[model samples]
Target: MAVHSNKTATLIVMLGALLLSSGCGNLAGHKNVDRGLSYIESHEYEEAAACFDAAEAAGENQRILYRAKGILDKNLGQYDSAVENFLKSLAATSGIPGDMDFDTNYYLADVYIKQEKYDEAVEVYDAILALRKRDKDAYYMRGMARLYSGDHDGATIDFNKAIALAGRNYDLRIMIYKALSSNGYEDEGKAILESCLNNTDPNMTNYEKGQISYYLGNNADAQSYLELARNERDMDKAPVVLLLGQTGEKQGDFNYAISVYKTFLAEDPDHPDIYNQLGLCQTNVGDYEGAVNSFEAGLALGNNEYSKALLMNEITAYEYAGNFAQAKTLMEKYRKAYPDDKDAEREEIFLSSR
Candidate 1:
């Protein structure tokens, strides 16, 4: 699973306005903080860290500074540090709930989720909802936390509330289904998805319909819808191509999947997730070297969400190519980076014998 970054473009813009209005006394500090956030959004973590350091030296607002640091730590998978920094940010707040407060709480909750502290995550979301009573995203996230914590009834109620608030939102519906289906509630998830298919929401785009069809096992319809959606102007092609490749894979056509991924990469080579998918397709076709190259290419794009998966897959590609020595070497590094991964532990044992 990928670590979600909270430094979105919208948030960055909001923060920029917030900092600028704080007066000319801390102008340099504010600019540094803003640049740090921009670097974070671009996945340039080292540059972001430098910018943050400069911001701190220039005496930026303590609350915003801590929150920005927390975001950085979270993106870098330092969950403990993230939690601590987020708490510090909250403590530095002026006892008034504002956008920064909400952002910090959301990021803190996300880090809690990453650490598998579901109850803590729920509490954070609860606080968020107490302030913003009609926040559908908060309800949806709380539902996930409840589901993960085994409070199925609470989860169901929250999910329903979220759905009620987000009328005709196919994306949110599909996300809700994914949360349920991945956590031992497949039948319930299927029912939610079925409702999407049956609803005559005119605002539903081809991509939304395709996503619903894909999850519901209607791959043919998914492919047709996704292909049409891919051609629409101003559409984000990454997701459309990704689903098309996945649909090809579901239909037992690895070559088609590879072709789809490669074509997309030919046009926009910056997407690390696509490279990860392409690498997996190559591995499926016994092109281990190609898989390794693809995975490495993705890893070279800085530490985005797919970095962990890409590194693991690269190690797997080496193993599949009969290069046990290289695989074991990579496994040692992987273990150090992700000591909690039980699967990696087992793989290490297997690789040791090879």
Candidate 2:
């Protein structure tokens, strides 16, 4: 039940902002920093790390270098390191809030949210809003922090402000609904979604319609809309196909979902998220070996946001295949990489007795 939202889009925009901001400074390490950023975009994390190191050796601007390191650390799930790097980046700033400063603050707040330090996240967002009162993203994110912190009324106020500021942005509406629905405000979330559906604008694409329908529990309608979106040559087919496959799964047709994923992969094989989804469907159908292969294919693509999930699923596939030895082997590596994962710790304990 994954909702296609603006979180990734927001990060992409932040990365672009960092690049643009860094260009303002004349530095010897600009090329290295640029190369590192490109590697990060492609999920070549280790390569990105090396490039960042080279940039540091070449005496990159401390602000840019620390921010780059913060981005990399965040991607690697090294939250504390990311927090430290972001703080260093802030310290290196000229005390003038620019795009880089704003971007760094957003990332810092995001990391705090991930850590469940909602109050800290709220304070960061508060600072942003004080400086740029019209920042809709800050309002929306602050609302999320408030929601997670159990301040439902305050969350609603911020959400309303965000919605008013970005009224035409259907994605923002969907994101708000998702946040509310996931945080025990289902009826309120439903109302927001239903309003979006009722007030359908002509400018809305089939993909947007499909997303709304899916969230509204209209699986059949979601599938039809997604298929239409997929057929449009101008549309990005990956998300359309992904959502369509999810619609199939929602309909209890795992085989259909698997076939959909396979068909898409046969044509466009580079989508890591698609590979992860395909593996999940394979696992559901008891094709543990196929699932492992799918997961491995995704891992080979590189370390994007899906990397941790792919590794964890790969271990689960092996466990389900009655290969506790292989599962334990993988789990040990996973534990080393992500020692903070309580689920992984429990899985390790379970595997030890097997």
The candidate maximizing lDDT is 2
Error of 2 at 143 (Å): 0.9
52-150 per-residue lDDT for model 2 (tens digits): 889887777778888899998887788888887786676555535579878888998898898898987887787778768999999999999999999
Q: Which stretches of candidate 1 lie over 4 Å from their true place?
A: 1-60, 68-81, 231-235, 300-303, 328-354
What are the TM-scores, per candidate, against the unseen true structure? Answer: 0.77, 0.80
* C-alpha lDDT of all candidate models, in order: 0.83, 0.84
Model 2 alpha-carbon drift over 4 Å, by segment: 1-60, 68-85
Q: Per-residue lDDT for 174-272 in model 1, tens only? A: 898899989999989989999887875788889988999999999999999999999999899999999999999999899999999999999899999
Q: Model 1 misses residue 321 by how many Å? A: 1.5
